[model samples]
Every structure is written in C-alpha cells, then in structure tokens.
Target: MSAKLTFLGHSGFLIDDGATTLAIDPFLTGNPKATMSAEEVRCQFIALTHGHADHMGDALAIARRNDANVIAAFEICNYFEEKGHGNVNPGNPGGRIDTEFGWVALTQAFHSSSFEGRYMGMPCGVVAHIGDKTIYHLGDTTIFRDLELIGEIYRPDLVLVPIGDRFTMGPELATRAAEMIGAPRAVPIHYDTWAPIEQDPAQFAPQGVEVEVMQPGDTLQLD
Candidate 1:
C-alpha cells in the first residue's frame, strides 16, 4: 500500500505506509474532531513533535495500550521513560532514526516544549521517508527561512502544516510556508480546536500548490 495520511484532529495524524503504521501528536481524546478514541487508535510507532499537553495528549496512554515505540526529543523521552514507557527514541534535531519501514529525521521547529508542569527540551518537526515518498509534518511552528533548505533537502511529496494563529502560523504565513517548502501537496492542521487559534483553511490555500483542507477524520492517499 502507498502512504496514506489521516488527520486525527488538532495536530494529530495517522500515517500508514504499508510496512508500519505511525501516529503523530495524538490529541484525539479531548478533541471534538477526533474520530478514534485513545484505545481505538492503532500504530506501530508514535511520534511526538513537542512536549505540550495538546501535542503529547493521549501519547503515553495510547502507546502503552498498543505497545508502540514513542519518538521525541531527548528531554521528552526522559519524561516518557519516567512514566514507565521504556520504548522511547530520544532524538535531537538533525538526527535520523531508522525504523522498520524507513528513516525519520528530526527537524527544527520554532515552538516551546513543556507539558504537564514538566519542562522538556526544544520542539521539533519530522521528515519521514517511506518507500518512494517523503512526508514533512511541521508540528506547531512558525514560518522560518530554513524551510526553504528543508524543502531542498527532503523535497517532500506532502507537507502537513499548522494554520492556527495565536500559537502557530496563521493562514497568511502558512501560505508563505507552503511556497517555501515547495511540496507537491500541503494540508492544513491545528485549527479550530479552540477559540484562541481558530482559522479557515481556504484563506491559506496557496496558488500553484495542491492544497487539501482535510477535516478531523478525513484521509488522503499520498503518491
């Protein structure tokens, strides 16, 4: 099977690349748009972009239930281990970890990383190469000049970005990010979860790029 991406509300996503099933930032339990419960979600690997409650929500619970490996920054990994989840891949920015399916590279993300009164390290994004396709998930971040470099390095086929302002990039900046990333297709995320970060996807559809405005449970097939 080709790489399939499903938006799981907020910053959460389920990615199936035939060999391995991966979930990212599982904030579904409390999210209104979430389709699956923490128990209903299945994945071989659970990747976190940061240590915020919203981003790391339901991660330990879901990973424990499914016996999945949790991937995140070193500081966040320590927190997971303290919670008795030993299967953690503590990675740093610019590092790549090998998984059963492919390689996942930790990239820089302009966001804070703290959760549950605990302070983790810096936040990060992910560049995953599965089969012939490369996917970029920009976990709660702002638009940066290095995005152009990331685009040149990974040349991702699909990019999952945040269009929710207040905390992350809004529609206007996110549109510029799409161009900077130069991905074939881009999907908006982390919007409409709360009043502070509400945004409309249509306002961020960049010209010449395939913009997919997916709802909570919508799934997209990646080439």
Candidate 2:
C-alpha cells in the first residue's frame, strides 16, 4: 500500500506512510466545518504551519496524549514546550529537518504569526517528504513568487493550497499558484470553515492541473 492522506478538515491532514503518521495543521476542535476531533487523532509527528488558534488547534492535546513530536517555528515550539509538551521540534524558514518518516523543509509564507497576542514566529509554508511522496502545504498566505522557487527545489508531487480570500489567497490566485508550483496534483483547503473565508472549490480551475476537492473526511492515496 502507498501513503494515505486523510483530510481532517480546514488545513489539517493526517498522512500515514506505513512507517510514520504525520499530522499537519490539525485544527479540528473549534472548526465549524470539521467532522473530526483532536482526541481521535494519532500521529508520530505534528507539523504546524503557523500560530493561529485555528491552525494550532488540538496540537498540544494530541501531542501530549500520543507522545508525538510537535514541529513548528522556533517561538511556537517554545510556547508549546512551556505549556508542558514534552517534545518540540523548532524550525525556521529556508531550513530542512530530517526525520524518521522523511524530511520537512520550511519556506517563506506571506502571512502573520501570533497566538493570543503572543509572538509565535514567522509564518511559513512546509515542504514535507513522507512515505513515497512529497507534499507542499502552503500554510496561510497570499500568492507569492517564492512558491515557484520551492517547487523548483523540491518538486512536490502533491500540493495543498488555501483558497480562502479574506485571510489567504482566493480561488483565482490559488489557481495561479498551482500553475506556478507545477505540481501534478493539488488539493484545495482552508476554505468553507467560516463566513469570511467560505469558498467553492469547484470554481478554482488551473489549466493543466488536476484539483482535488477533498471533503472533511476524505482521504487521498499518493504513491
């Protein structure tokens, strides 16, 4: 079997690559459109792209319960570590950290970072190589030119993009982002979770790119 990636609603996902389970931006608890809860999640590594409450949802609880390594920006890690999380892997943009599963490389994201008014660190995107595939999760950000550079360097097979306009890129911009990254396949996330960010995934169409509109409980197999 290849790797199984389950969409945990919003920007959250669980990737089981036979050897390791990596969870990214698991914001299920207070997510209005979420179909799952943090209690049901089990992963070896938890990767947070930013410091928003929605993006950081249930990470501490799930990490504490599963003894998973929480990976995020430097200050974000410190925040969680001080909050009693036993394991924390701090990282920064333009750097890569190798892990048992594979590797996670940080990239520049055009966004802000803060949690409850506390500084969390620079918001960044993530390039994760797990199981048999490579995924580029473009955290919460507007369209930027660096995405092309990331794609050129990593050559991710699948890409996850945020299509929510108020806080991130809208469908039109996200479609352009897909073209810039040149990934074979892409998934639309971080949309339809609230009123301001609500978007229709079908409306986003990038030429020569296959867009996967994943539901809250859907899973995608990549090998």
Instruction: Return the clash pairs for model 2, or none.
Output: none
Each model's C-alpha lDDT? 0.89, 0.91
The alpha-carbon lDDT assigned to residue 220 of candidate 1 equals 89
Clashes of 1: 0
Error of 2 at 168 (Å): 0.2
Instruction: Give stretches of model 1 more than 4 Å off.
Output: none
Best by lDDT: 2
Can you write out model 2's per-residue Cα lDDT over 90-155, one digit (the tens) per residue?
Answer: 999998999998899989999999999998999989888987689999999999887888889999
lDDT, residue 48, model 2 = 92
TM-score of every prediction relative to native: 0.97, 0.98
Tens-digit lDDT track of model 1 for 22-96: 999999777877778888899989999999988899999999998899889999899989889899988988999
Error of 1 at 151 (Å): 0.6
Please give the distance, in angstroms, between residue 119's alpha carbon in candidate 2 and its true position after superposition: 0.8
